[model samples]
Target: MGLLDGILGQVAGNPEIANLAERIGLSPEQVTAAIAALGAAHTQPGDTVAGAADSTGLSPDVLQQILTHLGGEGALGRLGALLGGAEGADGSGGLGSMLGGLFGKA
Candidate 1:
């Protein structure tokens, strides 16, 4: 795990959430609510911001900006995995598959 491994592990009450809210010009409550909705909807963590944009009426551009600010290249790197393109270290699918295993997708 990397530095963000510990950080990303803490979603609720994470100060970054509030920072993201401020950066996106939204209330922290709104950000959390959107995150919750997306989580329940089975949206990939990497895509949560984009999916939340649709549900919360936030612009995709702003959401992307928020993600970039929060994760930098690490976040960008996850996209391929989230989209089921990048292979995991074990060479058994990618992050999408890993998340599917967690959520019982298939």
Candidate 2:
């Protein structure tokens, strides 16, 4: 799998990110960059989506759509938990929870 495939796999199922990117007319690179920016924002406390839009030159609406497609609020929680090394209720560091931690939701 590609780098994005691996990274995004933490937030979504395989091929889901690719499908969302295609639907939103964004390159996989752009999407990946935005996701990275979002993760950074979680730590730095900046405008996560806006920073991504600025960097990727994608409209905020498009980025919002991508986030929504990825499961929105629940997705963010998962990302935060994942990044923060917080264990899920099952006592394992599941991908979604790990990602939630990354986004500072944990």
Candidate 3:
């Protein structure tokens, strides 16, 4: 569950994330499980997402695709969840290309 590990690593280190379980109103164990889910979740452009999948050992291409579709708000959370969230406010992955196709900055 490398993806999950990365997400957890990020969450654990979050200055704003006091207690994920507490904030989410989930038990510590449940929080762990959720983190695990994030790890297992997969994204598209298989090549780009493969390295993360290999590390996280997750298996949910569909979810990843959905997350990609969701863009900044959704995909971003997932990306931050995976990339430790220190990468700024920008969400993970390229939503522009995935959204309306490559057409330069709107």
Candidate 4:
């Protein structure tokens, strides 16, 4: 599989994709494409759903459904983590560090 496909698989497994595809009335492949498009659009400034819809040709409403299914705004952060954008220079997993900080760990 390609890098993006690998990331997608890690982010949303087959069962999740199948459920989302069925709910959105889109094929699993299309759902995957939409997820990728949303991830790409999220890197930019402004409305993610609109940008994803423009790129993927899947209406904003559908993209919104996908976004909500993927866990709303927090999904983008999770995607970024999967894409390696969440690692610190010290190699401490970003989310792990944040949670550790919350618990007063050194």
lDDT of each: 0.51, 0.60, 0.40, 0.71
What TM value does model 1 have? 0.39
Residues 1-106 of candidate 2 have per-residue lDDT tens digits of 2533565644444254566668888766666666665555544556666776776777888877766665664565566555555556775755544544434345
Cα-lDDT of candidate 3: 0.40
Better of 1 and 2 by TM-score: 2
- The TM-score values for the models, in the order shown, are 0.39, 0.58, 0.29, 0.71
Error at 15, model 1, angstroms: 1.9
Best by lDDT: 4
How would you encode candidate 1's per-residue C-alpha lDDT over 16-97 as one tens digit per residue? 5677778778776666555444443333555665666767786767655655553433443443344443566775665445
Q: Provide the lDDT at 93 for model 4.
A: 62
Residue 48 CA error for candidate 3 (Å)?
19
Report how far off residue 101 is in candidate 4 (Å): 20
Best by TM-score: 4
RMSD of each: 10.7, 6.0, 10.5, 6.5
Query: Which 10 consecutive residues of model 1 have the lowest summed lDDT?
Result: 3-12
